[model samples]
Target: MTTLIVLPLLWRTRAPFTSLLCITVAGFVYLATDGPGQPLPYSPLVAIFTVAAQGGLRQRRFAIGLGLPLIAVSVAIRTNTAREYLFAFFLFTMVYVLGVLARTRQAYTEAVELRAAELEKARQAEAERAVERERARIAREMHDILSHAVSLMIVQAEAGPLVVRSDPERAEAAFDAIAGAGRDAMVQLRRMLGVLKDEPSAAGEPSTSRSPQPTLAGLEDLVGEVRRTGLPVTLAVEGRPRPLAPDVQVTVYRVVQEALTNVLRHAGATTVSVRLTWTPDDRLTVSVENDAADVPGPRVRPGPDTGGGRGLVGIRERAAAHGGTAAAGPGPGGRGYRVAVDLPVVVSSPTEVRR
Candidate 1:
């Protein structure tokens, strides 16, 4: 009979409720038949513990319902004393409570591990997004720098040979402009490449020793360089001047640069007008308009062979980055091309401005 009661415990993990029922019945038979004296009921306790630890709500309730009566009867069969009944009840209750604690601890551990895995996955996704954004930013900067430089060089190159035999000094100036543009492009490209280098500086930060970004003050130089191409260009700035963040300045400069490059490459214009209007509402509006050239070439968009479509797209991106807007279309009366951008000026503190 004792062997019968012990045998059902083998299925405790796989079929805990069935194991507990079998053990309970065998135990009742053991007690009723007046079997050999045993100090405690071991197999029933083990089966009840397994059911409480591994079984669901219904199975656990069944275990408890059946265990209470089985424990009472076993204790009553063993000794008709209050102390023995109390002790047996306390032992079974303690085992059930322990099994419940083990189950809760297992659930908590699994939950923590699952939460940690989710957080790690999210962190990796964010890291990949950051890399993609950085690549896009670098692509835009490269496009702006290269397009403006190449446009100026092309204009100067086309005119250099035409005037070389007839006008030596003008040809010399054209050659000089080409050289200047090439050198400027090279410098900018070198600076860009330097950012990718893994060499750390003395402060353990990436090396960032490069020239300062172009500002509104450099617009005069820009206009003069384009004027050397024999295309009449005018710049007009209105309203009170105010400080702007470095990023805002770069956005403004690139917008104007791309606009002028488009005028040179696409619009065969006689005269171009660049305007910077600072309104009283903390907004700056940039406008570039060109009149149709006296001898217009084939009407084609700029950078057709050299990634042209991105110019306007890039201008819009820059504007949108600063919570601004850009519009490009025909000038007044549809005479020529016009590009305009409106930017909200964000002033940064002195500490935020890089020297």
Candidate 2:
């Protein structure tokens, strides 16, 4: 009766199967030598402590369950009477049950903590992606405003001397235009530098109302400035370019301007072509290709003082910021470098779409 009831408890308490077998062997020895009435009060207590130790270390419920009955059997053997044995068995079983319940509650708390840590990591990654998108939008805006101002300044600088001899009045007007362009460029440059230096979370005070946003509408003035540089640039529009976000328009214009600037400074090519196409699916493509210079020569290395090398890097950065991609390499026939950028058109709403 003792083995049948107590062994099952031992199994439940997750006692090592080998230790249970040894316990059985020891019980049989006591029965054979001193009979079933022999005192063994310590056996039940030992079993209880062993199971509690295993529960603390391994967090197994079975060890606690198996130890309970062994404790009862030990009390029954030591007390030497059925009435006292029953009383001790009841007392230990209640205590063992409470311990098991407490351990289970602790395990559940640990699992909840682990799950919370994982959720926090996921939330952080999402926030980083959002910040990257916003930074790119800001970069596109800065490029557009500054490039248009610089182009106009270049035009006014070239025209000021030509008109001075014929019409002094007009020449002074050109000089005034040059001064105004310089002030506008300085303001935009300061805004851009402030954004770069500010904390990531700080969206500083916005620029004042004086400097207007630049868009594709400003391309005419950009082409005129390139022409003033003595480079023949042909601008063509395949489809009616719809009104786009300030950032997108600026990105497209800068990509074309940077490519043409590269052609003028490095490529030494005569004729350049700039093409803009707007698709029905709200995508804009801009391409700039210049004719290859005669005679294949070794690649010219740009020095630290040169601005042409950094222009391409800046163009690529601008495109990437706007969720767009830019490619600039050798053109077809391996004759010249061609730069192209494809950007998605982002509009405000249904009303903006109709406009």
Poorest lDDT segment (10 consecutive residues) of candidate 1: 346-355
TM-score per candidate, chains pooled: 0.86, 0.56
For model 1, what is the error of residue 241's alpha carbon versus the real structure, in angstroms, after optimal superposition?
A: 3.7
* Model 1 per-residue lDDT tens digits across residues 7-29: 98888899999998998888788
lDDT of 2 by residue, 47-161 (tens): 4444443354543354446555655565565566878777766755655556556657767888999889888888899899889877765655555555556655655666678
What overall lDDT, based on C-alpha atoms, would model 1 receive against the true structure?
0.83
In terms of lDDT, the poorest run of 10 residues in model 2 is 294-303
TM-score of 2: 0.56
